[model samples]
Target: MAKQFENNMEECFSTSKGVFYLKSLSLEDNGSVSQVIKKRIEAINDENQESEEGDAFFVADIGVIKRQHKKWKTVLPRIEPFYAVKSNPEPLVLKTLANLGTGFDCASKDEIQRILDLSVDPSRIVFAQTTKQISFLRHAQKHKVKLMTFDNEDELYKIKHKYPGAELLLRIQTDKIKGSVNFGMKFGASLDSTKPLLQLAKALGLNIIGVSYHAGCLIAEPRAYRDALEHARSVFDEAKELGYDMNLVDVGGGFPATMEAGITFEVIASRLSQAVDDMFPKDVRVIAEPGRFYSTNAFTLCTQIISRRVVSTEGDSDPTFMYYINDGIFGSFRTLDFGYIHPVLKVLRKNQEIQDDWSGEKVYTSSIWGPTCSPDDFVAKETKLPKLESGDWIIWEKMGSYTSPASSEFNGIPKPKVYFTET
Candidate 1:
């Protein structure tokens, strides 16, 4: 099935009806929205015509990844992005980032080894996880992957004994944003505890080179970036007083892939650029660990509606329709737990033929589910969608990041195979 999807991409194959040039379609082309969707549906049907793989797959646009990198450079030109490997660790995504010269933010020994296998420089990888397994530390040392992070005093002792020569960044706790992923809870040292930790690192003769902090993932406000930068500056000042030549300050990952209305990347970048200029020196190299910002908008998910149910509702409201899709929360949607992500869904018109079910008062209140037997397998709840039937397909956008890498082949439902494209 994976091979067939790959072949379809290479052959630029489409159904006998016509070619659907979705690769060339832009988001701004609202006029071609239906045409693009029709093309995607055709592409999926053409590839999975005889497959028992349940007709669910992901389409990755390498162009979208490239465009995001360009946008990052255009916005915050100073800060280099270390693509978080945990986001979507698809081999293609990693290869695309490596080709773009983006660094990686790895968490486990496995992630580090994988990036290193790509012939990526050890310096281009940061073991961002503050918690260290001694064996993993030794593995990093053995591979010469030196840069890592530490927060608590116990981690200092572990690193002191396991990999004393490793260059370190003190991951400090930042202001917790309401409704954002509170990374500080698990990682980050308190501002008050940073000095003691740095003193301990000094006492142990360990190499503490700089500081890092995660504002929060899916930051709701741009002010979080500015505030986190300001907090990082204070840590830098303290590091200077402690006689450490802090050359870097990781303004950790909190960037969004696609911005909400009125809160644009331009606003965030402008704030970040100004903060970096004000807080740090010209020679000090600044970098970021941006996960979703680089990967989220790069892939599209195509799922077939396997089954559905209609249940009663109160008043004149349309009945609640349940849609069973091949993929679920356990699959590519594990990241949905972090924030309120409402995937923009479109019902694909097959062979450029509009379905009668999708037209005329078909806006039904619906919920989409995954194939797993677990009741927790809900994908989207309370979605207003056109009435759909079994085998009808839907496209979920902004699904590239935190989707595949986190998926599991649980309940005997295989992971969604991906089709990579330059378009």
Candidate 2:
């Protein structure tokens, strides 16, 4: 599986550094995943030494992305993945997924254009956003992107008049399923509105193709998908009664990138697979808009601590330490607005042996802040970590989704640079 990904890495370049390297670094050369990560980080640090301005960067493992695709193929073989372009649409990430024969779930005109620029077939793209600008709709139509999602009557009219040939999918509400960021509140239609929406589509002579629902983002419970699938089955029946061919069932993304305790991907996949098998027949095409699952685990964020503040506390408790990193909420930690917390941090010491025993090490209750001016530009609110100082480096895993795409240049903090490797 690793070899399959290695052969496709034609060009490996880091845009920020303006440097080029061969794509021949395979897993075998490094011995293990940890070794590969350490070697890559060392190389990145070597490059960073020449620049005066400290910049956070991402290490993207194409091998991890390929392994994820392979895992999906093994677990839920029937459901094809439409990689959500909104989540960490890094060029190399998209190119890798495209090369692996995965489809894309685009939301905006720019996203559609990005996928098209990759030379991906229009048939492999789904305009997955529920609300869209009129110009973006025309762009999709001009580009021949037929599959799109809608819920309300206004969207139906827009699609009917502008992109009449579009294959519409009714996005039903699935908020009952709790997640880190639930789309049911912002997107999906209520259960009561599903039938009328389908009727309205039929009245407008719109091509209603199927049903879709997003259980939530970073979902932990398998029962959530089971519940959403049941509603999808009901909507499929409604579409059929309205003389619409409801063949595609888009069980939208909520798959876990990193499972919480007592939860596993296999558990969710098994429950979802059983639900689909019991509800839909073999002819029905099942697809998912998985963004984080394929992304989060594939990238590691390397950030440098630029400054720190120590606040003395009362009496016996330890003082609170605040460490400021080069990147912040405005940069790769953009998803902090959605209540996503940074993972447990790993301290990478320069020219020092990796510490195995931290039992006697001085630990502090610390808060990591981004380099933004805003008081709320925090990455981790409260976590215990070994005392860190400026110039020291910290690493976070599972950072590829809902991070870079949502990043901004607010306060002049640029988005992190990304480097790709097949190993």
Candidate 3:
């Protein structure tokens, strides 16, 4: 399972499959891409993989995966990544996730078709559609993907008419999170509606084995999860009342991934673990769809400065500069407009430390604009960097998950490469 890579100006780039730009490196004189990466790793003395757990890439950090993934924990924590393929469906990413032994949570036929091309097993995928295309239902059935979701009767009927022998789960509608930006607006059928959805499934002889919900992304309160438990309890209670048995409870993907602030994993995990002990049904199998949590910090995107624009003000004003980069919204940092910050660090320039208070200081401001021809190419609307020149590399760490999976070459820009690490 070795991969081929590409080099731009001698720096090494590692995409999941072939060469990528984000993992780009700056090469020494007369160096090739592969050599550049090896040299960089050797210099850092962090390139060696000791144990599977300590390595950056490995299958699930769970045991068997280590052997299969070799030192990559054979794919890097095959946590059933249920990869939000819509985020960035580059074959490299899918193959990487698949190699890790993860199942997918596909939403559309095109997405399913794409994964199918790569030979992903139908059983390793869950067609999680709240709204599904009727034709795709038969494809899902024909393909042997046994699991799916719904919050309404229409979805139930569509699946019933197309593939009635399917297994199903009712999408539990989570309440509005106080300050949620993305997930609060869409999805869900209330506690009452869930009853009928479940009943509808029973009526059609659809195997209703589970119940699911999304607390929405970046939920602030541990209580939000705690509160959702109550909703789930009510749903589970209804199933029992209707003489139905549910074997699974899917706490769908709302495990927050860096919306600047939210409950930490240690805290949330502790709380949920306690709740499961006290409340979760004795016979239920617990499954979580965590698209962001595991992969959020797994990788980073490195973009070089293609150009720098300096903005200067008058009347004792400080000099502000913008470093337009080769990657932008197309690279999936568009959430910045909604205050999503991925924590930027300068990769090549080691001496400059990001300042805590540069308000009064002469701050050199710059914007890392993506390579799109559109005026909206800026990824970070206002970026503060040291006096940097063109070609200096900027590292946006923990960007592996949503970044590439959601990127687009709007201006025909070639997607950047992805490099994995066991360091």
Candidate 4:
């Protein structure tokens, strides 16, 4: 691929101070993922930085990097952030957040070890896994990791036998969002069963510290937090009655980002803030573990247009085309689950100044597929994009969340090419 047009706005674009998105490819002017990636990589090369061994990058310095550091006024003071490691698990994302003083919510021994290797203190990590693998339990206890959660009696027994003195938190079940993914039924103990578990922990001499719960992912209503907050308040009152001093409240992550519509962070934050102020005790250390909210919209996915195939829409009014990219379900795009219909952009032929209408207005029912041989290797079922041939790169914006860590090495299809982009 060659540089298609000379940029007259390159100077202004390059001088942008903080993290920016959607400033490239003035043709559609819709900000495609691949164009931003190309420009970002070019910038990195221009600065004489050696491209790392991997063809993939999250571009933290430009996007999440700016949000993590140097933008306290905009990011911090809004919400207390605890990064969910299962989302990306990459060292760059973990290390960057840790350096910014962000705490982590680790689910497994590996995730916990990775954080600790970065010198993230045990106190800064919540061994949030609801399940108690004996090895993970011992590791956390040995590391003096102060907090872990459980919703059942069997896990309490494991803790009692392996690490009795380990501090613990009871995961309370609450219905945060009605239609949201049911985090409660999956991992949490219902309100009725919790009292008996508290007794079991006491009998085993396990230390009970605090309580926590997750309202599910992509929470769209601010009232969702309020619903959970009210439940937490009741649970706290019960714990206090049980003669246990609870000082921590883990509001598990479900805070929605600027998704297509429905709910916004500011709205969710307002509700969460009010819930804490109203119900959460002042001394109760309030913290949230948000995975997608922080990193999702902050980054994009750039893939090469490897092949173009025609779609047969025999008598149908709408036409369809299939643009095969190098990324697949392994690319982490499937985690969106909530219909990720974001825009796509095309970077045209290199070495040419603006070709008059080289880009057409015609929209095609584009289904972007991955290069895997499996039938299930598709990324998007029916996406719309400008028709294109091989060599043109297509970009998917707001793909910073579960995309990378969720990538599978099935069939040995390499991960999609990655790059960072900002204004």
Candidate 5:
């Protein structure tokens, strides 16, 4: 696997400083991911004895991403994946996807430039933003990144004036499903309005080559894809009536990233593929923008406990504890503010035997706080945890999506550093 990765990805890893390398480890040789995390913590502790630099860090498994790509190909061979760049713009992650020959869904000029920096062809990138900035439009035109999405007539005019030759995807709104992020509220043209938009584009002599829709983020309803594809087929029919030969379908990202998601990727892929096969001909190119699907499971975060405070409540037999970690909502845990649930916490005691299950140990009602001055800088509330001390570690798995990229250096706390490895 390492040799194959080296052969396919080494050229993309070259930079001005040096070539980036991924530490390859087999489970039989190096044990499990927990052991790797424990070893990393030990090395950091040994090196930072005087500095006391117990800052949070991440261990990203590139092999997981490679496996995800392989799985995508095996399950949804008809549809191509254009990874959502905004999910986690870690350079190595981008390079790895690019090496695997996956296209990109870029929302900004910088994202386009990042993909281009890896020597990716402009055609492999789709400017998936609905309302693009004029400057960003100019940049995309300059770089020959032609494919873009638009939902409104004003955007059609903007694209016509700025990039008349650009191929376009008319983004239609999906059903207003409950319990999911409503991307339709902010973007996507209504099915009623898609025809008018297509007509306007045809009148402007602008190219309309596809239809796009997002069924919202972390959506569990597989029928959302079915309904959205039906809506898209209607738009495609409208375009055909307007003499536009639409050939692409951009099934916008919202695929679940974790097993905890109410719906599995396999089920969603099966439904989507069946819908595509039923609704459209095989000649049409099918693609999806999957941000969390490719990223969420590939990275794990480990934060060191910076301080611990025991709080006693009257009439309570056990004292409630509040432990503070180096990283917080202002840093890598910012996704909590956006309605993401708290990550399951795993305790790693200093100089203690490593065990996956801690059910036998004594547990206490605890609350975890971030190392921030804000009152709302809480990581976990009223959670059960073992007795832990300062300098001990807390592990969070499946933290790759919308964590690092959205992190801020609020209250002077820096983002966690990422270390790359492969299994």
Candidate 6:
């Protein structure tokens, strides 16, 4: 067991960028995530005995990430996952994914540099941003990172002038779907523009390798992939007519990471794999840029309540409560503003005892706020929970996506510390 743990830890740290250091505990004998949270809270209490400081922190389960990757392989064996670094770029997460032999989808020079710093080969990265700065293009050229994407004529001209040798994928717009974040409003060229773009690339003596499209984030319909794949096939045929042998089709990301999402990863994978098998040949490479699929459920965030207030409405007999936590919208809960994720809060502890549930107990309607002064920095506008006092810990699961990387130290409140465990 010790040898296995050491080997796993070594694999996780092998590609470290040295941006941060982490100490991970290996849980054995059926240890639970709640147990890990309890242990860390106790350690924090012991260390801050005099200050009585109970700050926010994260407990990341690295083992969960490994399981997610394994599941991805089992379900979609043909397609490769190029993790969207913008999701959670935690060093441990990156290192683990890198060691798992997954590719990376980078949007900026910094993201590319970070992956390169991990000693990752430039071949494993795709500069997926449709609109990119010239400086970013130059950086990619300097690093010998050749694969990239472009959707507009200006981008083609920029690439022709800057990185002429870079391989390109033409990003096409997908049909607008409801109940998902529409990415076509911002990126992707229309179908009418696809042939023109291919013609333009050919005229400019540029290499157009394939097609790419994003169905949208949190896609509700699995058939969305089928529609997008059909559109991509048309682009591939157009490229073929333009004397370009496109051998790649990037089915861009919108995969659900949690069970609460509109669709399951398994359903999406099943539909997507069938589409790919139908549309493209075996020689064509297929890849995806998944942001939330791997990180969402792997992290659990814990925040400490610093203060509370009782409010009595004019007509209501019961009083509503307001609780302020150490972290907020400007910090870890930044995704709330964008409606990307809604975390379900669990009480880790209240009055020094573990709180599994509030069953049979009187619950109060409460509002949760962050430490920032911004009135909009609310975690939950209305929630029902047993009365909680200051110093109590609240756990938010499935918080690994779009949280830390987008967070800021607004109002000078420190970011949460992260602890790692493998169960």
- Distance (Å) between predicted and true CA of 313, model 3? 3.3
What tens digits encode model 1's per-residue C-alpha lDDT throughout 70-104? 99999989999999988877766776788799999
Model 4, runs deviating above 4 Å: 1-36, 39-62, 65-79, 259-261, 312-319, 334-360, 417-423
lDDT (tens digit, per residue) of candidate 3 on 109-154: 8778777766778877777878888778878877887788888888
Higher TM-score: candidate 3 or 4?
4
* Candidate 1 runs further than 4 Å off: 1-48, 312-318, 340-342, 352-361
Residue 31 error, candidate 2, Å: 8.6
Best by lDDT: 6
Model 5, runs deviating above 4 Å:
1-32, 47-52, 258-260, 340-342, 353-356
lDDT of each: 0.77, 0.80, 0.60, 0.66, 0.83, 0.84
Off by over 4 Å in 2: 1-48, 313-319, 353-357
lDDT of 2 by residue, 1-423 (tens): 123235545555443323233354444443343465466556646755545335787767778888999999999999999999888677668877888999999999989988887778999999999999999999999999999999899999999889899998889999888877788888999999988888888889998888888887666676888999999999888777778778999998867765753577788899999999999999999999988889888877878888999999679477888999988878888776775534546786666544434568888889999998899888889988887778677788778788877889898877776656666
For each of the candidates, the C-alpha root-mean-square deviation to the true structure, in angstroms, is 6.2, 4.3, 8.4, 7.9, 3.6, 3.4
lDDT of 6 by residue, 295-360 (tens): 988888999888999999999988999999999999999988687766767885543556657988
**Backbone clash count, each prediction separately:** 0, 0, 33, 5, 0, 0
Candidate 2 lDDT for residue 379: 85
Model 6 error, position 186 (Å): 0.3
> What residue pairs clash in candidate 5, if any at all?
none
Cα deviation of 218, candidate 5, in Å: 2.7
Residue 318 lDDT in model 6? 86
- CA displacement after TM-score superposition, residue 40 of candidate 6 (Å): 2.2
Ten contiguous residues with the weakest lDDT in model 2: 13-22
Q: On residues 165-235, what C-alpha lDDT tens digit does candidate 5 reach at each position?
A: 99999998875754347777788898788878888888999999999888886676678778889989988
Candidate 4 local lDDT, 365-386, one digit each (tens): 7887877787777777885666
Locate the minimum summed-lDDT window of 10 residues in model 1.
10-19
